[model samples]
Target chain A: GAGVSQSPSNKVTEKGKDVELRCDPISGHTALYWYRQSLGQGLEFLIYFQGNSAPDKSGLPSDRFSAERTGGSVSTLTIQRTQQEDSAVYLCASSLWAGSYNEQFFGPGTRLTVL
Target chain B: AQSVTQPDIHITVSEGASLELRCNYSYGATPYLFWYVQSPGQGLQLLLKYFSGDTLVQGIKGFEAEFKRSQSSFNLRKPSVHWSDAAEYFCAVALGDSNYQLIWGAGTKLIIKP
Candidate 1:
């Protein structure tokens, strides 16, 4: 009965450093998503995974932002050579299935700070 | 281009006062709309959603929303708001044929007064 869970509630890294945020989706949730919430801004879509494969990576801001899912359960969002602009709360969500109707359950976000 | 707009950047209401948050979307097709609330230091929580039905939809925490195709609007309403309702409200639209792409609004911050 666990909801989505994300690790390392907070991460502070220097500019140009790399950080990996992890997410554990609820059991049987085939659809996983990653999002970024910048200060004073709305949530920015990052990537989505159905099972262990990602079909839509367009939301990724750049090559530096990448995400992957494995075993259809866990996901990792990696930000390489982070910049100040990348300092934000990284959130993950999962749903029973992928589509417009399904409600996504969100996890407590990982607050990443790039100094 | 698809976009969701929340015209009010902030709204303040006393506890027990009526509340209405406006949302408008620009899309030719009938869209799936959602209202989410994010309390400070917490994750986003779904308030309600409108896929297609009787237009009026009820959701958790004593909230409801009406989808008006005539105006391309889906406004959230609560007859009486509690002090704990003070938070950020976001309007979003699910677009694309199948990819779960959601277009989000800038969000409206709600303040509660005693």
Candidate 2:
């Protein structure tokens, strides 16, 4: 019954600092995804987790962007040495399975500002 | 490359007026198309989708979309729009054979006037 949830609805930090954004997907959702929404821009896919299969990191911008899904549930997206360009809303979504048809339920994003 | 385009960056419509949001996508093969709506300060919500079958498909919230292969378009339409319909709309395409990878458009901001 619970929807996807993200922590720290807002975060502000200095450049070069590292930040971790957490996402808790809905129960029984085997597929989780992380996306970034920049100002005046569209949502960019980051990483995807589906069951025991290897995660898809192709959309990750760089090495600084990394994510891990522990116990096939919660996921954390870490931005190391963050830059001003990384200032945006980090969004998380989950679906019943890893497919194109199932709808993804999103959580209220975490708005991050890099100073 | 797979991509989606929402030609209109912004659309303005009076309340109770007809609404249509254009969406075009480019993919190597037949793609799965979807339309999502997002209200300010909220997450994205699915409006409708077109996989195959009939050319036209209906969805929740009195919305519907028509998929045209020749034009590579899946435009969302509503006979009448409500004030609360003001929000951002995104057109997305899922790669049919790319393990469900989705390519999203920049999004269109809808402005509803009373």
Candidate 3:
């Protein structure tokens, strides 16, 4: 009954620095996703992982953004050389599996501020 | 490309008044529609989803949504709103294919007035 959880409720870093955001999905969940929410904007898809399959990186804005899900449970989203434009709330979500019908449970999110 | 639109940037309704939030989506095929709400500094909570079968779907907290294929819309509605209902409402559409990625709207901010 535990929902998804994320770490570092808030993060402040300088431009060009790298930061790693963590996500702990619900037990038995096989799909994890990362998204970014900018002020006055919609949630922007980042990446997604389904079990052990190759992660879907199509939504990743650039090569500097990457993510890894370990043991099909926890996921980490890393943004290398962060830019001011990358400042936003990083949200993580997970579902029973990757499908159009599955409803995703979201975490509180990590607000990353690039100064 | 799949996309979602929430035309209203913000809406205000008195407590106990009926509410409706419009959502329109663009996709090649039938889409999986969803409505989510987010309070300030909180995560998104699923209010309802429309996948198949009945066009009308009910969700938690007395919320419901009706899917209208003719209008390409899935609008969320509630008979009466509470003050606690004030928050940001988002409309999203999931891909019908393998990716399962969600295309989200800019979101509509709901303001509950006494």
Candidate 4:
């Protein structure tokens, strides 16, 4: 079985540029999550998708950040205009289902550097 | 809002010595507790979780955690630590009604000495 995978292990971009990060969850996983990890900081929850239900966007920092999960398998996190503060590792995770009891598997993550 | 706290920013333990990482959480009602380990340049690996039933939970790699409701704590412990155990440990809590969103701690960095 394959684990969660993310694209562009490392990305360097200028400030104000837009970037799209992709995540492919494990086969048959119905719960997807996105998180941001900054240096010396904890993992910050970004967004989450559970099957066909509405995605939880409360954790998204700003309006510039958005995510879409298509066909309940792949998820794309988009940053419209990146800022220097947005420089961090973006991690994706998935579980069999969205619940408090299920364990989530994580991806290697994409390190985004805004210069 | 649910929150987790890892009071120790860093801890160093000699190899073959007992290890304990303190984790305290704040949330209304019973919450789901978890401990995860993350090596440098790698994704997080779940150490253990406590949802209900037994307060003591065992996880992979000889790790275990005790969930104490009286203190609102879920501390991770291991009888002995290996050098490979050096990594950042995170304590997270999730409320059952929050759609599974986790509130994470600042993390504690564990260092192993020979």
Candidate 5:
């Protein structure tokens, strides 16, 4: 079976610009999550979606960060007015369900460099 | 707040030597524990997980983890590590709640020396 996949393996953008990272989850998966990884900060959760339910966006660092999952399969994470501090690898993951015990499959991740 | 702790930032082990990565978690209630491995240029792969039942859990690639509730720890172990086992290992915990948001550790870089 196909695992989770992400697009734009690498992205370089100037500060103050906006970036969008895409994620394609496995078929039949009902839960999708986004996380960011930096040199100092291991991996920080960004947002998560479970089917059509309301997304849990508490992990989003700021209001500029937002994510949307369409049709319960693909997800897009948008960072508005990106800052140099936002330079990091954005990872996406998916699981069969949203339960705490479900095992998540991760994507290769998209590395975004804010210069 | 839920949090995961990986005390060792890096560890080196010789090929064919035993390996152990310590993980401690803090949560209000019983937590869902997980260990994941990430190669240099690959996505994270699950090593094992502890939800309930048996405290010892086995995972792919000859990896296993034992959950100890008394210490609130879930440590990953491998009998004999191969050179290819060098990578970053992360410990994560999910709170026993409806959201199930995961709290991740800083990750430990595993180095294998021949």
Candidate 6:
């Protein structure tokens, strides 16, 4: 089976621009999550969607960062007015279900560089 | 607030040497623990996970981790490491049954030398 996949393996954009990253989870996954990884740092939780429940946006760093999952499969993370600090690897992951502990499958990730 | 700690930022060892990566979590009760690995230019892969029952759980690539409730730690160990085992290891914890939101440690970089 195909694992999680992300588009735009690498993206370079100027500061103050907007960029959208896409993620395609497994066929039947019900939970999708987004995270950010800075150089030599750990993964920072961003947002997650579980089934039909309202997505958890508490981990979103700021209002400029938002994500949406359509039809419970694909997810898109949008950054409005991106800053140089936004430069990092944006990662997406999916698990079998949400209620219990399930191993998360991660995508290769999209590296976003803001110059 | 809950947090995961990986004390070592980097560790260097020769090939075929024993390895151990430390992980600790701060929580009111035992939570689900996980160890993930990321190779260069690759995505994160689950090495193993600890939920309940046995304290020692084995994982892929000759890796295993022991969960200690008293110490609040889940340490990863490998008896003999190959050069290809070099990569970054992360420790994460899920608060309850929900596994979507996980608290991650800073990570430890393993350097293998032949």
Q: Which candidate number has the best DockQ?
A: 3
User: Model 2, range A1-115, lDDT digits (tens) per residue?
Assistant: 4799998899999999999999999999999998999987778988789963546789999999988888888888999999999999999999988889788899999999999
Looking at model 3, residue B34 earns an lDDT score of: 88
Interface RMSD, per-candidate values to 1 decimal: 1.6, 1.7, 1.3, 1.6, 1.5, 1.6
What does candidate 3's lDDT look like per residue over A8-84, in tens digits? 99999999999999999999999888999999889998888898564568889999998888899888899999999
What would the C-alpha RMSD of candidate 3 be, to one decimal place?
A: 1.3
lDDT digits (tens) for residues B1-114 of candidate 2: 777999999999999999999999987677988999999989899998888899899998999999989999999999999999999999998886346567889999999999
Error of 5 at A58 (Å): 1.3
Candidate lDDT (C-alpha), each: 0.91, 0.90, 0.91, 0.92, 0.90, 0.91
CAPRI-style class, candidate 3: medium
Q: Which residue runs of candidate 2 sit more than 4 Å off their true CA positions?
A: none
Per-model clash counts, in order, read: 0, 0, 0, 0, 0, 0
Q: Estimate each model's TM-score.
A: 0.97, 0.96, 0.96, 0.96, 0.95, 0.96
Clashing pairs in 3: none
Number of residue pairs clashing in candidate 3, backbone atoms closer than 3 angstroms, sequence gap of 3 or more or interchain? 0
lDDT of 4 by residue, A29-101 (tens): 9999999999888999998999745457989999999899999999999998899999999999999988777
Which residue pairs overlap in candidate 1's backbone? none
Q: For model 6, which pairs clash?
A: none
TM-score, chain B, predicted structure 4: 0.96
Query: Candidate 1's residue-wise lDDT over B32-81, tens digit each?
Result: 89999999877789999988879999999999999999999999999999
> Which 10-residue span in candidate 2 chain A carries the lowest summed lDDT?
A47-56
Two-way TM-score contest, 2 vs 4, winner: 2
Error of 5 at B76 (Å): 0.8
lDDT of 3 by residue, B1-114 (tens): 678999999999999999999999998777888899999978999998877899999999999999999999999999999999999999998867465788899999999999
Instruction: For residues B3-69, write the lDDT of model 5, one tens digit per residue.
Output: 8899999999999999999999887677888899999889999888888899999999999999998
